[model samples]
Structures are given as structure tokens and as C-alpha cells.
Target: MGSEGIMKDVTKQGKATVLALGKAFPHQLVMQEYLVDGYFRDTNCDNPELKAKLARLCKTTTVKTRYVVMSEDILKKYPELAVEGTSTIKQRLEICNEAVTQMAIEASRACIKKWGGSLSGITHLVYVSSSEARLPGGDLYLAKGLGLSPETQRIMLYFAGCSGGVAGLRVAKDIAENNPGSRVLLATSETTIIGFKPPSLDRPYDLVGVALFGDGAGAIMIGSNPILETERPLFELHTAVQEFLPNTEKKIDGRLTEEGISFRLARELPQIIEDNVEGFCDKLMGVVGFQNKEYNKLFWAVHPGGPAILNHIEKRLDLLPDKLDASRRALMDYGNASSNTIVYVLEYMIEERLKNIKNDQEDHEWGLILAFGPGITFEGILARNLCA
Candidate 1:
């Protein structure tokens, strides 16, 4: 199996820059055990049976818990939004939109400050998420709040699901590559709280979901050749590939139900990885002019969909258990934050990888980043580490 590069490997080093990156999460960390306990109390389900099932579901090679922005407490605090009759689904959606929008703006502002860039310099804004939905949504509101140029290109991408963080990177890379001297801000905030239903026969998993998911947001600043000159670089974009497997449609899906947005994850999701990931990696690596073995340092910033998915990938790729520690840690700490989860993993990677840097000149390390989503699609990037 020959490894190759899929897209144009932007080899001519145009100044490398990730001007800034910021992440935000709810204050409280929700434990899966606590969720199972709640489910047992709320639904009168068998505690022993439910606990055993939850233990299996919570088994991740790396993560154990996740942050929840709107717990039962947050909802209770915002009684106006969750009101009896007046607070329609539309109203509840508005509340979530407002909360996540503010989060994205704050994170973006922090990134700009850290990287020393002006909001005026930002020419494009990209927002990605699957957990929450709204119209004239977070990205547009964020641009306005920051007083960015009205002419700035605004992109609101949806339904990419968990893979959205890295997928947003790919989208921004294309925009930057085509527009000279352009700066873009990418923001992702995932909140599954609105989708948290009390219980229903249609969604037996809601109990697990209410326990597992948490709200989180991540922002990154990317710029073309000029800004890279002043910015501290983390990794340079080499090539990115988005691959969709044929006939594996039901692995993960987000659909609209009467209650709110519902998530359907097939029991066979692990098996889907078993059958497809190796070939997917083979094809992705082929696009980057490198074989798997030759790339000494690999950064697998995978979306922590759950414990089982991560474990399956680790086994399939024959990666060391520790290889996905950042991802597992993020999940244990934040749960599956849907689209924004990968950014947390990437943040941990950047923090750890940058610590050992000896110089700013030797930027030759190679890395791989992967994110999976509802389309049963995988978005991968082969990048060169620029931390030195």
C-alpha cells in the first residue's frame, strides 16, 4: 500500500502561522456514573443493568468525563428559557444560540489578544458545530460583536458533526491558500444540552447522552504569508483529505425529531472502524508523500466520539495506548463535545509539543490529524510540525 498526498501539498513555505488558539468549557464536569445514577432515579430503570451498560459505553482508551454547560442546574437558573408554555422549541434554541455565540466571541477575542492581531485584520470568519442549531447564527453574530469588516467572508458549516474542528481547519486552509495576505478565524462551540430529553422510547440513548455530552468551544487564528512572519507557529498545513466510505451510512447520524435534534449512533460503529480505517489511512497518507512508518511523530487529534471508538482505532492502527492520551483525557474531562472535542485534543498536543522546542528554525516535524463525523466521513490532515 503506497502512501501519498491527496491535495496539493502546499510545499512552498508561505509563512507558517496559527496566530492564536483559545478554548472554553462549562464550569462543571459531569461524571458518567453520576449520569447513570440520575437515569436510574429518573426512569426507574434497573440500576445494576443500566450501570453495567454505561460502564461499557463509558469505556474510552483515553477519556472518562466531559463538561456540561447547561446541566439541570443551568436550565433551572434560566427558567425563562425553559418556561412552561411560552418557551417553545424556538425560544430554547435562541438561548443556546446566545450562550454559544458569546463563548465563540470570547475565545476569538482571547486568540487575537494572545497572537497580537487586530479584529480589523480578520478577513474571514468560519464557525463549525453540530450540537446546536440557529439562524443568522453564532458566526455572523460573532463577526458583528467583534466589529470585524462587514465584507468579511462568513461561513457557517453544519452537519459535519464531530469531525468539524479539523474539518474547519481544512476549509480555512483553502481560503487562505487562495487569498493572499488573508487572515481567518475558525470557531467551534458544541452544545448537546438542548437535545437532552428527559426520556422516550424513541431515544433510549438520551439518558446516556445527557450524562456523556458537555458544552465546549474552541477558536484558532490562521493567516496567510504575512501574519505568519510574526506569529508563533504550531504546524504548517501540508495536505488534507476528506474521505467517505461507501455503504457505511448508519455509523453516526444527526436527525431532527419532534423534541429537538436527536443523535443515532449505531452499535456497529466500532465494527465500521474495524473494516475501513486502515484503508482510509493508507489513502490519506498516499496524498502526503509519506508512508506511515517514515513519519516518526504523528499527532492523531481524533474526535473523542466515545471510549469504544477511540479504543477501536488505537487497536486498528496498532498505536500505543498512550498515543491517544490527549484525546482520552479531553473526553474524560469534557465528554464528547461533538465538533469542538478535536480542538481540545489539538490544544493539549500543542501545549505538550511546544514545551520541548529548542529552536525556532528547525520546523521539519511531520504530523497527522484525523476527525470523524456523521457522514461516516473522515477528514485528515498531514502537517509539518513548526514548533521548533
Candidate 2:
């Protein structure tokens, strides 16, 4: 086949379309009010001023409540849970691994059911997380727990941080597009409770993650099959791009220390996004023959890294006031689940749009899903919703 002929064949096979999505959160609740007024206050008892400062910062995150794998009772008993380097931290990860894996299984089941109920049909599994930072990967556990075929191709992505969900989708798209008739199950989960380190006044940056991070898992079904096969709303993948900004390595850093994984969140993250987000968006829009045009006309599913991240992206992109409500709302409701967070935002977008179908005109609505991670990496997908 000539180049044009091959291109024609590829278009005929169609890109991967998101068939369904399911999300799960743990039962243990950690309300922001408790973290600010009680947990942190008690942990940082020696410094009332620092406690007060943390309380005020916690509220600014806009995360009201988050479900963690750790129980409040357990946390209370092990005050050192806030601080790592203990044998207790190792035991905590063992517990976290189980909980996070179960969450992934539950979410995957939901996605499978919504995608026509065929667990055996899943040919590939793309699991994303950064919670445990362990081995034997979550993908194998997920496959075994879900009773998938023995030959199922599995890929577990670790340490991708906040961009893991989009990373899963990008990989699933490639797998599905290359292997026609294959169904790709993408699962994203995290146990951020393990990342919560021992409280420290000296490393104020560590608290940025504690204040915003939470735990959750999300599953999305992507396949190369025709969109008409299922009634679920479809996000037909069009284009995706990943870019790492130059000289920005230190801006968003996460490192493991004696006190668990510590995050060094730059105060200027919002400014960085403001300065560079447009160029990234321009690259995506440019793919669909639009460059430097009106951005308000587009639908957005941005990763609300925190309240500041969302606000900065909105202002920088010159988007509508509510353009990032799903992202903001996810943060408010679920905190930042890291790699799993963006999928929750996408799930919210799917639920809201599916519930309020106004007209046939909206059968196809263009959207951009964006995520930010370490290395100052930007992940984006240009997609179109195929209404049920």
C-alpha cells in the first residue's frame, strides 16, 4: 500500500474510543476540617503558629474531604504515620497495596460491565499509579483478581505521578489502534496515605502534598471497535502530546526520604503554568487545524493539581469561568488523587454530560484533557464525545 493507502486503512480502523469509565474511593474519610483543626494541630503540637498556618493553607486547597486507606483510629494510634522511616511505614504500604489493588479491581469491574460485560475480552491492561512505589506491579494483581485471560498483556506504569491517567489513555490508544478488535482496560489507582510523611515545620513544602493529596482509583475502557457497539458516551481519541519544559526539573519534585516520599511543590507552579500552558494548548489545537483561535469554544478537563493549578490554567488559557468546574469540583470533593485524579474529573464530565443531553447537536463535542506531573511534564489529549 502507498502512504495514502496506508493512511486510509488506518483511518478506516478508527482510533481508540473510550467506551466507559468507573471510579472508586476508599471508605475511610479524612475531612479537611479534621486535618486542619485536629490531625495536624495535634501532630504539630509544639508549634501553634505553624499549626495555624497549615490550617489556613489546608482550606485554600479547596479539598473538603478525602477517602484514605488509613483509618482515623489507626492514624491516631500511630502518630508517626505522619512521619515515615519507621517499620510502621513499611507495614502501612503492605496494607495500602491491598486496598489500592482492591479499589482498582472494583473500578475495573464497573468499567467492564458498562462496556458490555466481557472481562475475558480484555486483551490489554494498562494500569497507572505512583502510590506504593513497589514491585511485582499492580497490573498483574489486577489481572489475577479480575480473572482475566492468562495471556493478557499487562503494563503497570509507576511514578508517573499526576499525569498517569492520561498516560494510560495514551498507551491504550496505541495498543488498540495497532491491534484491531482489541479491548484495552486502563486502570489508575493510588494510595496517597502512604505518601503522607511525618509532619515537619522545617520542610513546609512537604505539607503541600499532605494538604492536597488523597486516594482513589479510576478505570476507563478504550477499544478500536465501532462507537455504535455501546450506548455509553465515547471520547474518540484524536491526538495526544507529552512535553517536558526546559530548566523546570526542580519546580515539581517528589523524592523519597527517611520520612516517606516528600514533595517539593514550587510556590511559582501557577506562574509556570500561566507562562507555558498556552503553548501546549496551541500544539494540541494546532493538530486539528486550529491555532491561536478562540479557546472558550472548547471543552476542557484539566487536572486540578490544587486550587491554584486550576485557577492558573483557567486564567492562562483565557477560558470561561466554569471551563474547569469538573477539575475544580473533583479537587474539592476528592482532593488530589495524583495520577487517578484526572480520570475522576473525566468521569465527572462524562456523568454530567450524559445526564443532561440537551439535543442532537451535542452528539459530537470537542474537548481537551490536560494533566501536569513531575519533570514539568504536560500531557494532553484532544478528544470528541460521541453521544450515546
Candidate 3:
């Protein structure tokens, strides 16, 4: 086929669309109000000052509750986890590897069931996580647990941080669009277990992480052409783009140490993202043939990295108070589950739309999904609501 003919053939296959979304969380739930006492008790910390600081942070994060892999049983079983200077990397990895794999399997099963397709129909799997470090990785385990074909093409994205979910979806979109008849399952799972540490005066970021991060898994089914009889397209992904801000490499940093992974977030991180987001989003909107469009005309599914990041984006874009409701609600209910948080926000959007539909409310046809992570990366997707 000539270039034009090939282009026509590809176009006929259609853009990648989101057929379904599913999310799973660890069994242990912690309320923010009570977490301060338990955390201090678990770590055997006697510093009243640090406990007060964390209490304030929890309140400000707007996270009412969070799920975590860390529980009393596990902590009791592995007491070294809460100690200050223990080389517990092996133990942490063991716990997280199993936890993330199981969560991914549950989330994927929910997504496939919602997609109403046979497990054998999944042609590709894109698994994303930052909480587990192993040679074979969780993708292999997830595929086996889900009973996907041995030949299922698989790619694993590790340590993408908060943007992993959107990054995975972008990659899945390419696979589905390029390969006709492809059904891609994108699963993102994360836990704070690997990074959990005793609060220290030296590592203030650890407290911030304790206040902001949570554990969860999210899965999405993506395909270019859907079987109308058995599949329904929720969001049609039109364009996806990623950009790394210059001179901001040190804004967000994570290191793997003998103890476990450690993270540092610059106080100016939110400001840096706010400064660059408008231009980055404009680029994404331009690809969809919108120039200087009204921001409120479209819905938003932004990663709620923290209350400040969401507030910054809202203020920068001049968006309405409710423009980021889904993001805020997800943060309040689940905290920031790293890459998995975006999936929660998208799921919230889907549920809200369903409620709206029953009430005869209208929804916008176009929307955006945005996430930020290490590398100071910005991931954005221009999407259309087929269910509208």
C-alpha cells in the first residue's frame, strides 16, 4: 500500500479508546486523624514536635483516609521496617512484590470483566510500578495470575513515579493504534512499603510522603476498535504528549538505598509545575485543533500529587472550583497512590458521568488527563467522551 493508502487504513482502525477502568487497594485502611499517633507509636518516636508536624501535614494534605500495605501484622512480623537504621531492602521488596502483584491481578480482572471480553483477547500488557524491584518483575506474575496468554506482548515501566499511569496509557494507546485488533491492558500498582521509613529530622520528605502517599492498583482496557456488541468506549484517547521541564531535574528525587527507597521533593516543586503546565497543556490542545480554548469547557483528571499541586493547577488555568472535583475527591479518599492515583480520578469521573446521565445532565465531549512525576515530567492526554 502507498503512504496515503496506509494512512487511510490506519485511520479506519480508529483512535485508542478506554473501554473500562478498575482499581484495587490494600486491606488496611488508616484515617488521617488517627494515623499520627499510630505512626509515632509504631516507630517508637518520642519527639512530640515531629508528631505535631505530621498531624498538621495530614490535615493540610486533604487526605481523609488512605490504604497501605503496612499493617500491624506485617510490622510485627518484620519489626526492622519501622527501625531507623536497618538494612531491610530485601524484606521490603518481598512484601511489596507480592502485594503489588496481587493488587494488579485483582484490578486487571475487574477491568477485563467490565470490558466484557475473554482473557485470551488481551494482546498486550503494560504494567507500571515503582514499589517493587525484582529481576523478572511483577508483569510476569500478573500475566500468569490473570491467565493471559504466554505470548501476550508485555512491557514493564518501573520508577516512573506519579506519572506512570498516564505514561502507561500513552504507551498502550500507541500499541492499540498501531496494531489492528490489539487489546491492551494497562495496569499500574504502587505501595509505600518500599519507601516507608521512620520520621527523622534529617529526612523531612519522609514525613511528607507519610502524609501524602497511599497504596493501590489501577487497571484500564484500551483498544482501537471496539466490538459494539460487547464493548463500550468510555473515553476516546485522541492525543498524548510528555514534556520534561528544563533545570528541574532535582525537584523530585528518589534513591534506592541499603535501607530502602528514599524520596525528596523540593518545596518549589508545585510552583515549577504550575509555571510550565499552561504551555504544556496548550501544546496538547493544539494537536486536537483547539487554540486558546476555554479551560472550563472540558473536564480534567489531574493527579492529585498533593493539595498544593492541584490548587496550583486550578489557579493557573483559571478553572472553576468544581473543575478538579474528581481529583480532589480521589485524594481525599485514597491519598496519592503514586501512578495509580490517576486511575482513581478517572474512575471517579466515570462514576460521576453515570450519575449525571441518569439525571439527564450533560457532559463535555472533550477533556484532559494530566500527571506529574520524577524527571519533573508532565504527561497529558486529550480525550473525547464517547459516552456523552
CA RMSD for every model? 6.4, 4.5, 3.7
lDDT of 3 at 373: 89
lDDT of 2: 0.79
Is candidate 1 or 2 superior in lDDT?
Answer: 2
lDDT by residue (tens digit), candidate 3, 1-388: 1112222334478899999999898999999999999999998897878988898899899999999999999999999998899999999999999999999999999998898878777889999999999989889999999988899999999999999999999999999998887889999999999998998988766888999899999999998877776678999999999989888788898899989998789999889988998898888777767777478878899999999999999989999898899999999999999999998999888888887889987677788999998989999999987875
* Candidate closer to the true structure by TM-score (higher is better), 1 or 3: 3
Return the candidate ranking by lDDT, descending.
3, 2, 1
Could you say which candidate leads in lDDT? 3
Q: Name the runs in model 1 displaced over 4 angstroms.
A: 1-17, 38-63, 72-74, 77-88, 200-202, 226-229, 292-297, 355-364
Pairs with backbone N, CA or C atoms under 3 Å apart (clashes), candidate 2:
82-197, 82-198, 83-198
In angstroms, the error of model 2 at 325 is 1.1
The candidates, ranked best first by TM-score, are: 3, 2, 1
**Candidate 1 per-residue C-alpha lDDT over 1-388 given as tens digits, one digit per residue, 9 for 90 to 100:** 0011111234453633465688877666766656666645443445465566666555532345666666556556554433222334564576578777777777787777776766666778899866556677777888888788889999988768888888899998888777666777899887775675544444557556755677878888876554334567666777778988777677686676545576777888877875777777676667767675443346666777777788888887787666777788788777778778777887777766665464442223666778777678888887766654
Global lDDT of each model?
Answer: 0.69, 0.79, 0.90
